[model samples]
Target: MQRRKYLKGMATAAGIVTVSSTGNAQVWDSDELSKGEEPKNPSPPRKGDSVMGLTDQIDTVNVGIIGLGNRGFSMTQLIDAMAPDKGVIKAICDIREKPVEEMSDWIKEEGKNDPPATYSGSKNSWRKLVQRDDLDLVFVFTPHQAHTPMAEYAMKKGKHVAVEVPAATTIQECWTLVDTAEKTQKQCVMLENVCYFDIEMWVLNMVRQGVFGDKLTYASGGYIHNLVAEYFFEAYWKDWRSKNHRKYKGDLYPTHGLGPIAFYMGINRGDRLEYIASQESPETQLTERAKELPEDHWAHGADDWANGDTTRSEILTEQDRQIHLQFDVKTNRGYSRKNELAGVDAYHEGFPSQLAVDSEGHGFVDDATYDQYYEEYRHPLWVQMEEIAEEYGGHGGGDFLEIYRLFDAFNDGRPPDMDVYDAAAWSAVRPLSATSIEYGGIPVKFPDFTRGDWQNKRKLQVMDFDTI
Candidate 1:
């Protein structure tokens, strides 16, 4: 009560400045201040048993794809690279007809016996694709808001779902995914390709081998990229990316930075995110750029930019480990996932890639030593799939590696490397941090989607590469 009062007083003193659609500043209702209060974490009415090691082996994964944009189209090509042995694209969908038809032709050209069935020209056309009894797996590469609904519907239809990053936008959607996946006994995997990057995998191998030493306590990572042109222009189908900036505050996109760190730290495996607090820089860069658009541009009328130029969130784990995450896309900077991990004996930071051991001085090792570490500790999966992944080509081959692992697990009738709990836990950062920032950086509790099952120690399925 007192904190809310203080925040209200501050808002009143500062006049609660809110931007109108025409880029004019105006006073907003103080009632909006109450939005930051911690929401009730209610258990779902329908309970489902834990799917910790669930498996449904498939002879071959018959795949259906929704959303044929840049990411979706690229994924089709990657799936084609796997072909009839591992999987096949049975059907494809999009809101527009051209891409669907074009992709079908491309797949036909790739020497498949039959072209994939196409669904398009309707917003809800994806439903028909998911309802198909032939599909064993459905890939959702749609817009952010559609991820949860499509994934849930697919799971309920008895098909496993693989969705793009930040699998959900809200906490409710996160729970919906968890519950649906559990009840239906279908996999709900978030396609976080960064988790499969060669450098990230090497680090995972080192951590598993105890090279980072015991009681690893702290780590930090972030997504820093210059997407101004893509976000502001017509790069998106309907400028949905920028609309999110105008509709929400705090870390809008978080999984790219958080996913690999979660794996390194064993999130939802041994430890889980307990709570998060965040602070965001004032909204300046995006709003200023929005004003520069011509009057006829869609963004010309968009004045209320809710997200900030940068957002920093801190998380505490159940084991008292600390994690830091950052989200930024407006700034002009080289792309980085800022992957960093620190333990008692050593430290590692990516994006220029550095590694340090506990020597007398304790600094980054020499170039030769770094090269040796890469040679010695390179993850087995990377060693096995590097050539093929490179040939397939997506995000330095991480994308192809991720798909290969997913299908490998399916073929072997083993649980996936990532599961529904992981999808929920990692994507929960977006809403949790937004609430923290809204309530003046108050710490917000994270719902343990695992329902106390995370304490059972288990190996990450991806690390079990001996089968390869």
Candidate 2:
């Protein structure tokens, strides 16, 4: 893992090379590219060469979903709920036959006129689903490692992609996805459901309306949970998550916490992530907990878990906005994303969700004021879809809202709420954090996946509630 020098004009380069495994790049600056210096690595698209406003008007989004695992299977309900009107599931795929067959049967039981075509039995089976011309949109809910390649493949095959969170595991993979999406001129959206959470949306609306004051000083977020009992044992299909914990040292699952904060701070739009430094607590609990598992369990005798009990990362935005993120799954703690925000005039925090405004000296506002703010600033999307979201019920209805927005964007022939740059920038935190930790918590430069275009401010589609 050789670290290349951070190029001075990477953001301005006409063609940029793929990042190395160590999160550094061997770039071809605009001068070199203009002088006919061929880049050894594949080059990413130039600044402002983006799929930001890419559009293809489809009357009905013919959907294909790969990976019929737990998360994938659950998403079928959301897709089903939107079928015939917004989109229809045209194909389904998995490496295992059981889940694929089960999904097919479920589609049949749901009385779809055309039960989705199923593909399975081989690792490459998903390519069949992606290659289907009938599919206008593809939802990739595969494991973390496969997300980037799957998304790149789907986009190159002429289908819009909506992939599950943390779309790429490495900086190189992030560049690959961004380049593929740009080359294909197709939408590559990361399905970060947390951005659609009720509190998050409401706070976003408030921030836009100046409720959080003019300058947002700092924010805090985390993906803190205790997963040893379930996810480490039987939850993940092949112990993928546990295995990742055994191999990786950074914030493996960062999007759940980072996505909402990015939206609040306008990452990859009006602001860019400049750099991050990360440190982790020593590994202790997971090793001790591994002994409790049966001998046949994957973690039964595992003592060399690369992940520590906790990891903390501090990020600086180009606008000088500070963000603090925490990741921990080895602890026996209650679930929380820690969503916290602060401004000169107001402050808020999620998980018991308190709000205070008017002055920093003032403590949290009374319940009455908080409830009033909710009534006054409730996001229009939530206002319109709250009933259905609550009924569908996934992650306090954020999951349904996320799916709704995806299909809604497809139906209207508009850019999704999150595009490739957003996906790449958010997911890059995983690798960037890991690299920082690897170097004893030195600050690692964060890639501007949007290139220099992050300087241009733009409105988020999610804020435009009147459209969908």
Candidate 3:
């Protein structure tokens, strides 16, 4: 099937219009909107081709996962669910004993005969896991600080590494991972979950098909739901939150909001991140609330730290594209995580939440007004996501697709959807954004992690659905 045919019936209010085909750029009307459900088409070649092709070329690429925390466990579950035809999980490691034991038991209980060998001990146990010659790829899911060291170790050991978000905590570490990957000729991918979201993938498909005209500018959005009190009170990583709360406070988690935008904008591949400036709200209600807790409470000491407020980071690309990224743990007592994207050329399409591309020639507005308009113009990805959620079922089904792609890449010897440079560019934003906060909201230049050859990088591989 042609790429453009997949975008049929994608329209939304607020002038968020998407091109219908490669040759014909038509604004889809409300009548084109999918109502009940959309049919599942064949898999795209770029999506599954590389991995499928590589499976026969290479033998099994043994996988190892480090840091079996919440995210780590989720990743392991997804890997287990992959059709055995792809790859197998060979090892698992974590400092926390409980998760390691639990994951091992779960693997055994499920009768997955190829269950990964479990490793757990002191914080330094990660080195042992990376040194294993039996492993082909290692997934680093530890905290922000450990991303660099673990990645470096894995790369040097001739193992491909897939680190969790914020690939590195500092600029130096960022370069270390990139340089090591280049030196070792091994892949190091930052597992930015948002990049694999079905909605994001669909939008990428639209962009590849030129459904959105020469993309002008796009915006990335994020909102912190500080509903989890544990983040502030729990003694996580030597109580790091309470200890350094004041030192590094802005945009603590920027990858989820920035990853999709970077991929869609071709950051590193076509466009480069020029600079970033972040502004944080002076008052932190959440921090103040933590202070009021009794001294006996686990996080009572956290109150003595920094205030809990909102911070917004605006990054500009070399191509002059602007990405408005907002991060906040303070909310008016509610649950919310908002991610939105805006483009000058194409209409809007979003799922798992409301999104619309204005087709009436009207401009964009705030979420409230956008929602009012979205009721009129809606994209088919909304309904499609529900079915996707059911089948894949990780991080709204995006997780499963990501793992599937990873295993396929190993099998086919093709680069992943989000490659080494893509990982560095997106994950590096966290520390780079933090620098702005350190400098009192000043604009900071984002390092070209690719050492300035980002523009000449290979074009992203697209999954050819017809061949599948």
Mind sharing the TM-score for model 3?
Answer: 0.77
lDDT by residue for model 3 (1-468), tens: 321232232223211122111111222243543332322212112211111111213456677889887778878877776535676777889998899989988877766546678788887777887888888888888777788899988988988888887887665676677677777777887787777775566666656655556664766666565643555546552634444455566677778877777767777776888656777777556466667777886656454445337778887677767888877665664443345555655555343454445556565445886555444322233333456545758877777767766766677766666666676667656666665665555445555555556767455653334211
TM-score of each: 0.90, 0.90, 0.77
RMSD score of candidate 1 (Å) = 6.5
Summing lDDT over every window of 10 consecutive residues in candidate 3, give the lowest-scoring window. Answer: 43-52
Candidate 1 lDDT, tens digit per residue, 1-468?
554554455344322332211222233344654455323243555467788899988988899999999889998888887778988889999999999998998989888527888999998899999999999999999889999999999999999999998899888888889889889988999999999999999999899888898878898989999877777667752747877888888788899888988998899988988767789998777677768888988777566888988999988787878899999998878998888999877789998999998546568999999999889999998887788889888988999988988988899899999999999889888887887777677666677788888998898888886766
lDDT of each: 0.84, 0.83, 0.63
- Estimate candidate 3's alpha-carbon lDDT, on a 0 to 1 scale: 0.63
Which candidate has the top score in lDDT?
1
Better of 1 and 2 by lDDT: 1
The reply for model 2, stretches above 4 Å from the true place, is 1-48, 234-237
lDDT order, best first, reads 1, 2, 3
